[model samples]
Target: MSGQAARNVLWIMCDQLRWDYLSCYGHPRLRTPNIDRLAAEGVRFDNAFVQGPVCGPSRMSYYTGRYVTSHGAVWNFVPMSVGEMTLGDYLRPLGVRVAVAGKTHIEADRTGMQRLGIDPASAAGVLAAEGGFEPYDRDDGIWPPGFSDESHRYTQYLRKQGYGGANPWHDHANSALGASGEILSGWNMRYAGLPARVDEADAETPYMTRRAIEFIEQSGEQPWVLHLSYIKPHWPYVAPAPYHAMYSIDDVLAAKRVPRELENAHPVLQGFRQAEVSRNFSCDHVRETVVPTYMGLIKQVDDQLGVLFDYLRRSGRDQDTMVIFCSDHGDYLGDHYLGEKELFHDCVTKVPLIIRLPGAGARRGAVESRLVEAIDLVPTILDAMGADIPDHILEGRSLLPLLRGAQPAGWRPAVFSENNYAFRDFVREPLGRPADGCHTIMVRDHEWKYVHFEGLRPQLFNLRADPEEFDDLGADPAHAPIRERYQTMLFDWLRNRKIHPTVSHAAMTEWTRKEESAGIHIGRW
Candidate 1:
């Protein structure tokens, strides 16, 4: 095996961050200098999309390097099958220690473990959780009562720091202190204006940063992949003291929507707009009050990233480490009359993807607009590490060639994203169709985007003409050819390809031979 100079990988993912929110990505008011610096010194992918728009399945794709359908974890809380392989399962055997310092959103395959007679509380089970990443510090980012005990470590750390409460994650990290010293929980969006109860340093983003730095500092003698995931700019928009007040209402961007977008909406989307998360952004007052805090949260993440980058340089590991910055998915943030991501809009699917290699000075500050998917990260990292790419198991192609400033011939012409909102109970809409009918697929190329819902009308936008996606031409007969072309593409994209190919080629060959040698084929003959 050839030893790669970029042995260490720092995979950082920010939750619910929009692609355009960063200064490098053309956010006019929000100045993300640290993240922008990554763009300045690395390869920035202008059009990187996630396989799934929601947290769980999106992250499953990132961790497993497979699509939601292939992994069998199509929605939040759905367990990835134990038979499936993960990044750790592939990398750890090659002497690379894969560890996560933050959320993976990976649900453990408890049924598989139980059937296999593996103790769920054992070290093996914990490692088996989310593709077998050794938890340097795993926080799933949900801290409500009974939501998860894995996050109790963070709560305990907060208690040690004098953040007292039954659930310190809610009280200190998520809540604000009113003038009367009462807890103003972040659940109330109106309270987003108030500063968080905890100090800025003790907030979730900084805390996760510190934990990641500690992991890097102590990961002695082993070439490792450290996933530093941040749950900022996701929700509970209140930031701590200084960050909370960093931006004012005036800094908030106008909602990216037109009044006419409501015309001819799909049933799935009609239900999405009425969902609690989506409805919150519909109020103009909520948009104005909460957006600044959202910006502050992003700024806080950027500042912490600065700390992380500085630490790498000071530790003298900057030259041998690969730093990748992206998000699981983007936030709608009131775009298209929606708030949270579940739709196929650019604001929800297109994420900021910046990759900084250790010695990629030749292509430094270069930008690649070729269509890329979040699933591509795994193969790319493995290739960068000089490990064998598992061609049969992984569906994404490596971006190493693109990173080296070489354009491969015959790259994918379009990108795709999917969502299964119908299975989710949070969306309590009576769409008259079964849960499977709520599935939606999006196929987008350079100029047009086509969204197909199983039971509702399709949506097509001439992206070149309507960048904001204000006009839906699915109903226009003039665009029939365009719609048909994209429909064929989508159909061909999801055609009868293997979703489960667990057995190796040699094993399959042996099994087929054995079956043939036996009298199994005699009756058929």
Candidate 2:
């Protein structure tokens, strides 16, 4: 051990990597020894969930320690409103420098920046716009012709490497070359079998890993929080050499589904399955080609994790740095006949949460099965850095007690997740329901999972008996009591989401006592 307290944080998040794909998570074929090592040494949370199922909103929840509703950026490409306190806002006050590299999926709050008279192009404004993380290198990973509509450092690097096409991101990292020398872009799911036109090291995963290592090595005289976000395992499912051919179709696990999920499916599920994007993975041909490539991209990530962990240890930072590994959300990958992450299912909601605190052999290798959410990470990071948690700003509780092998009383009975599918174009006119009526809320406990769509029949699964979620018991007469219980739970959960406080209760009480001094009588009003 470095004999110092945990003064630094290495927050690593991978895009769209599912929890079950790791061998430590019980996958038989996928061997992620590097991530497994982190699990072996750190505390692993078995039931952590993301607040949203997609990229931008999920990342917003993670960075702000708040729910999607509280953050108000409920979908992709939407900027989180400025003045919504972020980890940077919380940590920087205590002298912790939070530096970020790789993707944040953040769209700058142009309106707020303008209103506040902050220059959007300035470094300070950029950091504030991106959840307050100082950029070691800010690469949103979506370049030219993608969601971001901009060029990134990775694209520039590709140009320097003589892959000088007009769209290097597509040609080098996201596309494959045809025998006729045509470019088969990986964006098309059918072309996933093709390998990217780059070497393993030049790939997005390795490039980001190298940049994170550089940031750590360049740190000077300050405790820092480095958000090392990786954009692989979430994509145009092609991987570079070695990783592309690392896994075969035989290694792909059989998609978990029962014929009954399609029979009398909830309107929400039916709508998702019929969407243009979801239809691609409905058949065997696409799944057979795409799933293997997805697995390979994950393998590449695992290999890079091995690299980063080794570097941390070699630099003696491993003993003093708190290492956290998680994902924004999981990909469905044909689960429930759905390809992308939408609708409420364990396939899309549940993600891996592993944390290795500083110092060796301190509650190492313990697993906590309690319900935790992605929103809890910011508070936990703040706690680990010895900073006071600003409870009024963050909606999550810290995991420090659990990390020390102590379970606090009054722990939550269930975890909650939500999706606002109402605004999506596919569901705009199909269901004839109000836009708000297309939203869904998920409440999951140890034994049961309930999903309630705004204006449709709810779906329920007794996870104790059917862990794979094959059958829906929402409409069963015998399960009415169970359904009602969870329904009430969801209602209360929404009705009682923590109200952001302008002043603490004690402060309010103290001020009320001096109301007469200020010429305002409390009760008379």
Candidate 3:
């Protein structure tokens, strides 16, 4: 507490990793001893929601320390507004070294990155995008120039390792990557999760952790902020060796499968359950293979984490580094008939959040039931490092109060998440229909959830009576009052919010098709 406020912040983020998957949160099947240990070692927020269910927008929120709506990181593929302030901006002035690993959907252009103060020049790894690494190391094997898959390499790697499944929707074409022994340089051509299937010596995580350790080692004396984002337990359901065989479907149980009336409640959630229903997963190959494979992948990540932790401890930085474990977003791995992430269910929106503060007499092993959002990470880190809060950033609050065991007044007991079905131009598969024209926005209190699907009918659930959100109160006359209350709140939300206009829906669809179109990048070029 006496030294300068600069502390080494290691942000460990997982892709499509859910909150409930960790054993600390009442899941008996998911073996997350590392997360469980982290929960025990620090504070775990029971109700932590993400800014958005998808990656890009959520990552943007993480960078700016603001929610999607406020930060204007509206959807996937949209460049984060360069003019806006960022966590890097705050930290750089405070003498902190900011570095990113796995993913950064941050400002797409050079101007944006520089403006936000993201030191891409100092980045240890920038997997997909070019220009992140300066002096270049070809031996790294983490990336090949013009290599375009922006996410989930480990899962794709595992699928090629004998974890075969069909793309019945014909939506997946990367299955051939394994057969040909030819790696597809682009995003859709190669399964994103496949990279994790490599051996420990060659795998991405070990390499990444090694890089983290190396960065820390090289810093003879510098306050570093390392964002270690791991892509695992994601899609393609492909896991490697013992991990690909770790647990069985018997070992992995299903989430609460409620009735289907309230199911149609959100168009943002349409095609969700069916999308999860793969004729492949949960079958013999799946039960004996897929589930265990995912567990194996998770454990693989955990092992690397343990390695990174060991490095920190051995270097005497254990108490000096404030570690945080979280995820960009959660996945719907067969939950509600969804294969990947599109639905706004708790399964995909609620993420594991553990914050470990480094200081004498700082509270440890405290589990706070307060609701928190992923967007809060930026400000929290900044506050922890004693940085100034730029007045323009307004979506999230500093959690210094909660960490200090003081629940300050005026704290909203709810968290919000909004995702436009039409705006995610960069991602394929979770197709969006204009007629459906669904816009989903959620406001959840401790015991209730208010879900508004703009063009479709709304959904209201009493989490106290139906934790599964099975019973819809929106249509019931008896609950009409509650609906009105939520509706008013939704309006109030709009009143205080600024909705950034994006490229039209047609523009989005056109871009998506072109980007995924057999090497297509533009229309009528």
State each model's CA lDDT, in order: 0.85, 0.84, 0.62
1-525: candidate 1 lDDT, tens digit per residue: 485738799999998899999999998999999999998888999999998899988888888778777787888888898878888988888899899888888888999999998887788788886568898888875556535353457877888899776788888789998888888889888988889999888998999999998998898768999999888888878889898888888898889888888987766677788877778898788888898899999999999999999999999878888899999998887888898887898998899999988884337888899999998999989988989877768878888888878869999898888888777555535767677677788999999999988867799999998999999898899999999999999999887334656756567669867888885785673
lDDT of 2 by residue, 236-300 (tens): 88888888877778888888877888988877678788876678887777888998899899899
Per-prediction backbone clash count: 0, 0, 23
10 residues in a row with least lDDT, candidate 2: 142-151
lDDT tens digits, residues 236-291, model 3? Answer: 45544445455655776764445474354444454443332433332344334445
The residue ranges of model 2 lying beyond 4 angstroms of the native Cα positions read: 1-5, 143-151, 514-525
Which pairs clash inside model 1?
none
Please give the lDDT score at residue 417 for candidate 1.
85
The stretch of ten residues in a row with the least summed lDDT in candidate 1 is 143-152
Clashing pairs in 2: none
lDDT of model 1, residue 353: 98
TM-score of each: 0.94, 0.95, 0.77
